[model samples]
Target: MARILAEISRTFGEYLLLPNLTDERCTPGNIDLSAPLVRHRVGELAPIRVATPLVSAIMGAVSSVELAIALAQAGGISFIHQNQPISEQAGMVAAVKRHKAGFRHNDVNIKPSATLDEADTLFKRTGSDVIVVTDDGNPSGTFLGLITTQDFNFIRHRRDEVVDSRMRTARELVTGAEGMSLAEANSLLWDSRQDVLPVVSADGRVTALVHRRDEALHHKFSNETVDAAKRFRVGAGVNTHDYLERIPALVEAGADVLCLDSSDGYSVWQQNVLAFVRKEYGDAVRIGAGNVVDGRGFRFLADAGADFVKVGIGGGSICITRDQKGIGRGQASALAEVVAERDAYAEETGMYVPLCSDGGIIHDSHMAIALAFGADFLMLGRYFARFDESPTNKVKLAGQVVKEYWGEGSSRARNVARYGQGKDLAFEEGVDGYVPYAGSLYDNVTVTLAKLRSTMISCGAISLRQFHDTARLVQVSQQTFVQNSEEVQRNERPTVA
Candidate 1:
């Protein structure tokens, strides 16, 4: 016989937080959003810590290399999706690892002897107006010169004309020595009145380009996530079926961490995958697992050696698993249950395994509520899919610009391994959809984080730990929720003219 739990499943919308007495020290400026990303001793710092408690979901539409770079720069992380071929996914991981702060690598390069048409092709392919001409046209070749769109026009120059005829000769360009600090490079750029300063090695090879605009944008990323080598930190998603082949490739490509991408993760297959990772890499690799919804599921993954346990099943914005299979707990209920287990486990073993609330985050308030309930971080799909940094194409629909969003279980993604429903996806567990387009990630995240900081301030908490220790919440009835909305609508109504 199936057992029934006594507690009713409750979502984030059913709860409200009560404000605590504001202390003089509890200000938005004092609030620190840093949180652990992996398991660690009770008193020791986690090996990996995200500057912010936000991570983009491991979905095809959300976790592109571009989005991963932007989020890491913004103090968060994005797990590159694993739905593609192993080599392709590994390449994405490599691209993020190769990204340097305030420096552009030689993706924009051409041979000095190349024709103008060839140079133009390279410029358009890289989306860079300024092209660095090298002896051999490779990133490591000897520096030759630089060319820009302003140097030549179709009417003035023939397509077959060699690039050397129009490029600014190396003698004319101001070059910085290798290992020049960003501050020093910026100083030279402004003082010399140059649009860019190419950093060169002793062998006279152009290593990287320091752009004037990149310098201005660099200052905004004080909390960017980075590895020991100073490269931006990024995560990759792996699957049980491809673990043998995918894990090594991603690790070789410099993925800082990996997650087992799945819709439901409380199975022996997951344990087998964990065992394999442990046997192969030991503690040298950090991997997270799950979409578990309760204490039992959380304990299962934790015992199997997951560095972090993701909580929530069928709670994503695009998910239809609950409707298709009726097999999911409400996100709030699931998170609360797993948190209780995490606390108990910590008490028993003195090892605190971080809990990631994976879905059902509709409002900024839900983020705060999840934190108060002991979620170490939040994983979002729809929230990130609406941003400009996401990989989805922007299309006009119903007079509004929107971006595509879909679930891994949807026919569109056909991620059978994530669902573990056999050789193929037996039925649709997710849906394809669109979200209203939001502007740049920097702008949207700034406002969202501001609201989160304000919420913490109002609760008189200056840190995530303090917020968890002192927070209070009350369940709201449907009538009260309706009344609250009505009051807001009334307040928003305009006064009579």
Candidate 2:
């Protein structure tokens, strides 16, 4: 069809598309693929949405908090990462909130002066489930600790006994987060060889006490995005209207963000899905539309009731939209253009719709690039492929660790036997393959996000929004990218388990 259109352009058009596509950044009819633009808001007080705005990279891994905490701590979300059980996913979500909001109470701190009766009073009045023993739970204050009536016996030589004499210090207490990553915190507790660590705030007030067993369970965040400082949208991908029929199920399963996944997501089929969602679901759920390279497509989705617009066409790691179909634009260039347009629409409508740079991000640098290029959020693929919480197991191929990854738009994807068809295809039994096991999700997030934060600090930017606009991009020659990869291979000496 593109060839036929190309021939027609050749016959009568002074400006042609077929050859213009060779420009790689060119579009037909002076579309100025780069003409679209977006402006984001960032400031000292801008709410740092560090719990929402995340999407599980919908692979074989069951969406779970194993990945969610990492995303949530950065104001991103994670899907349950699996189709095993809804109850299990709910548990993860609950756990994520616990992890992020670690230790929200200071008055709950068990001061040495408090008697057994006082502990019961605090618990009764505040409905607090736990209490920590401390002189005054101040970080700079002398270390004091926590205790309950059950602990009263050990220190109870007399009712007048000062709680500090036998009370547990914050160091002896357990720690946790509501939705943030807890690996480092967990490690701290483990290294201390303590059974519990009282999770406290910067002010040194104790909130909750985590036991070792708490770390063994899963964690999760909401699967949807809301606004600045908040991003976690979870929804099943709808390829066809027939798939539209399955929206409610996903919504019931706590899916608040819908992704219309397809290389040609702007197709009439997709438009219909967007339109229906806008008219029917209203604000109850967030609709994400795209895989688009231009603003016109972005506008179409926003107007159609999409709460968020997904950008980039055929930039997926396993995607061959540029090769198989011989069509595509550089992901960076494509996102920059569409984001510009979307920003304009948001301004005119007084409605801000966020964009996710949907693909082509490989390393931490690329992720930073995507954010700078106008993506409100970054959608990663291959990066999450080797994670422990990923739905599938790992395998060795030619002595290299790899996992099975595929395009959502592939023909085989069209008739998936596991996840059913259309919207029913929210999940498949999963591709039965193994990924080269990479130790822990914590390790990946620790290394990757730390690098991102350091880059932000170097750029003299504090928040993610600032990081997006001020980041400097230096394009690499193919040689540079290759050499960089080699250097990485040499320096990244992970101890193989």
Candidate 3:
């Protein structure tokens, strides 16, 4: 008398169908258990890769420190949004790094006025393609002009009269506000018809230069050879109002990749935002757009000439979209259908549109399926919510204890973000919100990532990208969810981080 199937994984948020994972079947170790992740290169930088193939949505302030850090540390990247002051975003990013030592200089910047020779030397010596340009007149340290090594070639060979003569003025070059989303930047770049962009500060100072590079940094997803790195590449999500208004803050803050942020990305405001980016900023920076799941939104974004499209309705732990709106696609089903059609579109036009599967990947297998189904990058939101280092969670939240945390799209977030202009939280709690107490961030990140790495090794893949290509996936119905319950619950690790 065996009940063929009974309820299983229900206790652990019905989002997951199967949760029983043992080291043996889960992963190997230190091997390439991934796929050829980075694709669609725009220029010099490596095609972008989200650690978890997921990201925290730019939901106002809700994608607080806990959420963003937990996702990033767990191998997913989170976009810090305009939920609050510019300073808060910086602090949040700082906190995302599991350890201080792993972060490259977050604020690494250089002057655009340095020289064409300087530009060449920097690239040749350090092999770096990105640089921050500063101006004395601009408080944000952006400039009206910039000179790249490519432009510098003419100056170096004496083809131009001087560096100043060969320079592309900020007006002539593409420019994305530091505050804009990556999608906005890409859209602007495409419309501007320029390859290079100067990210300017609030005062219009050229803080850094963002540009699209070449094929090495890109890969073909399905058929169309869209440049993943070039398109999905994003800038730091600054917590501010008026995306353009935050540009100066972003430039000063050292964000070159722009991720145009919005909860529902298919709206007129979002489209107009990208259009404005395309018209005003032109083609200075690569753009990334999303937090969308259906083809309508995807098609809309592509029709808008978005270089890359983000796919996902609601997959985050803290997300209440389904509950609030009663709309969403199961992540796997969404990715499978969308990716297949997207690939077909690519085959027909030779213009591949990349998809970032942005949610509901609770396990490593989900990551593989996302890539196989045709997602270029995965942006996990809640998985990274509990990290110890994220700025959003300075303190812990518990009944007896209190920690710092916020919701990206919460009413509280809207209120807290309006500080300084007599609009900021003058009423509802001046200080940031806190969560019930949680434990250390490092402990959670280290163990989880190690397992992910080991999982990758078992697959015999060198990287996450390869895992997509090599790993095979099968979809299971609710029955799988039922049988795996007790084991998953029993083995379910402590709910910390």
How do the residues 390-415 of candidate 3 rate in per-residue lDDT, one tens digit apiece? 43434423425544555453445644
Model 3 segments more than 4 A misplaced? 1-78, 85-234, 238-241, 363-372, 392-406, 415-443, 456-465, 487-497
Q: Which stretches of candidate 1 lie over 4 Å from their true place?
A: 108-173, 193-196, 202-204, 211-218, 487-497
Report the lDDT tens digits of candidate 1 across residue range 381-407: 999999878989889999999999999
lDDT of 2 by residue, 1-497 (tens): 33342221110011111110123222222111111112224212222222322355544343444455444433355544323233454444444444433222233555677665666666555434456665564433433665655566524456566666556655555555433345666776687676666655555544445544445422322222233323233334444544444565556655545566555556666678777766777665665666677787888777766656777666666566565556666776677678788768866876667786777765566665566566776666666667665545456789987756544444434434222344444432222333455655556765665665555555555555554555555544557546645744356768989
Against the reference, the lDDT scores of all candidates come to: 0.89, 0.52, 0.50
lDDT of model number 1: 0.89
Candidate with the greatest TM-score versus the true structure: 1
Ranking by lDDT: 1, 2, 3
How many angstroms is residue 371 displaced in model 3 relative to the true structure, after the best TM-score fit? 4.2
Q: How large is the C-alpha RMSD of every model relative to the true structure? A: 3.7, 13.9, 16.2
| Top lDDT prediction, candidate number | 1
